[model samples]
Target: MKPEIAVLDIQGQYRIHTEFYRSDTPQNTIILVNGSMSTTASFAQTVKNLHPHLNVVLYDQPYAGQSKPHNRHQTPLTQELEADVLLELIEHFDVQYVLSFSWGGTAALTALASSPRRIEKAVISSFSPLINVPMRNYLERGRRCLADCNRTQVGNLVNDTLGKHLPSLFKRFNYRHVSTLAEHEYAQMHFHINQVLSGDPQCYLKATQRIEIPVLFINGEWDEYTAANDARQFAYAIRDSQFVSVENTGHFLDMEHKQASHISKIALLDFLKPPAPVITRPAQRLSVAL
Candidate 1:
């Protein structure tokens, strides 16, 4: 399904590029939030699959893709700012569900905690509110590489870390893309890593505690980047949250290790799919011909 494209102006400060995939029938809308370094274009397949069942909204966050910040003053994208932008979009589009991946979950969680009236349910993948020690180390390494203008080191860092358990071909592709990042892109990376490093655990805890809607948190069993245990802890903080670990997988649950992708997909779809409407037949009046 082709999406209706639009550029949303956020209080006239910046514009975010968005794609709306409407279902044949009017259905509840679900927003697909991208992870760091990912864009709306990456969700092409997802939009196609979901548009048939639900209205899907895909947008590029500021500094991520087409959502470039016009105001140079607001250069770096912060978690709070992203959350505010997401909330505005939710209100504007009347979104009812959310599916966030990796770093994208940060904004989703924050928005749901702050203003969850419009969001009934959410699915968060490979995300943890608190940054564990391993995650911090990886972030710090990536930050240093960016700071030192060693962009090429990013590929090796990721291959040896987050992408370690991914397929070899995926590792090569990841390396090619990440290792050759442009100067401006590297700067954005620095900002993202720094924001996470500086995040307050207490703040995340409070925010998660505020969440009252049902949420499903999925993480790879072998994930060391975000640490599956940490993701479990984050899920535990919420009043209504379920945590699932995809077995034989690493940070990227979609990598299809031992059919992990299939498992994760099934779990997500089962949780997100709205219940089928019940059909009832009117009782026929008894024939009173007698």
Candidate 2:
């Protein structure tokens, strides 16, 4: 059966659009966060795979999918704000693990760091703690194209930045999604991009340092935006985080490559396995003293 969609009013300020998939025999609850431009729909397959063993929650950010519309004025949605929304959802659903993709990783890490006791494990995919020069340049170009409302230029830039790296089949899908974005959606994405560019990389790194739960960093081996080295650096910052590079994968590890998707699922399941319960022995009566 399909999951039910719901809206959460966060502190009466933000309305978060979410989908919840309940498992018959739930072991843990996973909160899935989509990338900057993507929505909860992007993770349809992932939720299906995890639903048998876990109760999964998928949500769109404030400006992103079915959530409330936002524009340039809301430019710079701070990671703290994003973390706040996510924390509310976690508390509502009693989420135990968080799984984030691309830009969503920032908010996930922030929440985990701020409230270490609330989460048990986290899996971050295709995210970089620090933005590299090439990625910055690409984002800048995309922003300029978007500002000018030049669809042709935007398409060309996206192709040059992302399409060239993806396989032919996935490239077409990527282009279709990018080309069809509404103007408000485009603006929202641009605002997110700007926020990421202006963010302090050290903050995310420090957040990782403060995380005590198990963290799994998954990156595509050939992802241009987030290099493997950057993923490794993020893992290194966390005390005992694990890093996995999906072979022959690009930015969209779960969607583009089946092997990579399989690997990611395995890693996630292994990391999220519930710890053995500690058995406590009952105290002996005072008969011995008598």
Candidate 3:
């Protein structure tokens, strides 16, 4: 890691933490926003592997990871604010591509919604489409669950919710690694959830349709509830989108699957490097798009 690690002020309102991976030249610039509970370290495989030729920059999303907390007591910083930060960072570093996972995907699209012209190609992995049916219902339950946070409920959340997609091998896995994060980090993570689950509550659906950049969405096949089917529904709504369903993986495609790595290398890389995509609604709408 020959790159520098530091933070830059964004209009003096918010701070953007940036990490430049050395070796990867200026061929491609990817701004990766991890999930609510994750950070740049979680995406180490991609960041290190795509280096020398690809300038991969990963940052903390709002209150998650190592980012500064919100200025006010707001659950999530405005999607517009996130976009503004991304535009500033992109312009500063000349970034054109992005890879978003989970909540970060929502943030990425939200940023794109606010400023469609800032990004060119985006690879969204195992992201939440925020569909009205499942999204609302699950989130409503999650809020109630958090209200009564206890060991039993936490265990249930891990098992019934997060563990629903994993194989039996994961059932026996130790949770000590999961509990390693500090208290503030955990609370901040919950704060990020409020952003993802209920943040922009009044405008989430509209934002999804507003995405104009060419997006490649990759979803796992065996994910319990959040799987390729969910990604397919997300693909239908977006005007210009591509969906690739991983055959033998769960929700954690980046870590659990091998073919996904290949997809990023071959198909994903090919699509990203070329003429820029039109940054608005497509010229025409197809019934079975993406």
Score candidate 1 by TM-score against the native.
Answer: 0.88
| Model 3: per-residue Cα lDDT at residue 172 | 36
lDDT of 1 by residue, 1-290 (tens): 67899988886666888889888886689998888767786565556546677888999876656665443434676777889889888988899999988888888888888856889899898888777788888899989988887856877988898788978887887788777655666787789788767767667767778888899998888888776788777655787888888888987777546487668767877888878899999998887786
Better of 1 and 3 by lDDT: 1
Tens digits of per-residue lDDT, candidate 2, 1-290, equal: 68878887887777888889998999889999887767887897677667788999999887767885532234546678889989999999999999998878878888888864668889998888878887899889888888876767776677677546666776676677677766766786677677777778576887777788878888888787887788888666788788888888877787776787788788778778787799999998765554
Sorted by TM-score, highest first, which candidate order results? 1, 2, 3
Error of 1 at 138 (Å): 0.4
- Which is better, 1 or 3, measured by TM-score? 1
Highest TM-score among the candidates is held by which one?
A: 1
For residue 217, what is the lDDT in candidate 3? 84
TM-scores for all predictions:
0.88, 0.86, 0.74
RMSD of each: 2.8, 4.9, 9.7
Candidate 3 residue-wise lDDT, 1-290, digit = tens? 66677777778876666787744346667787776556666677677546655777877655555564533334446555666677677777778888877666766777777654557788887765544464455556655555444334444555455446554554434133234444444555455556666555535446768777788887777665456666666655678889877777766664554566665556556667675577896588659858
lDDT agreement with native, every candidate: 0.79, 0.79, 0.63
Winner of 2 and 3 under TM-score: 2
The per-candidate count of clashes, in order, stands at: 0, 0, 5
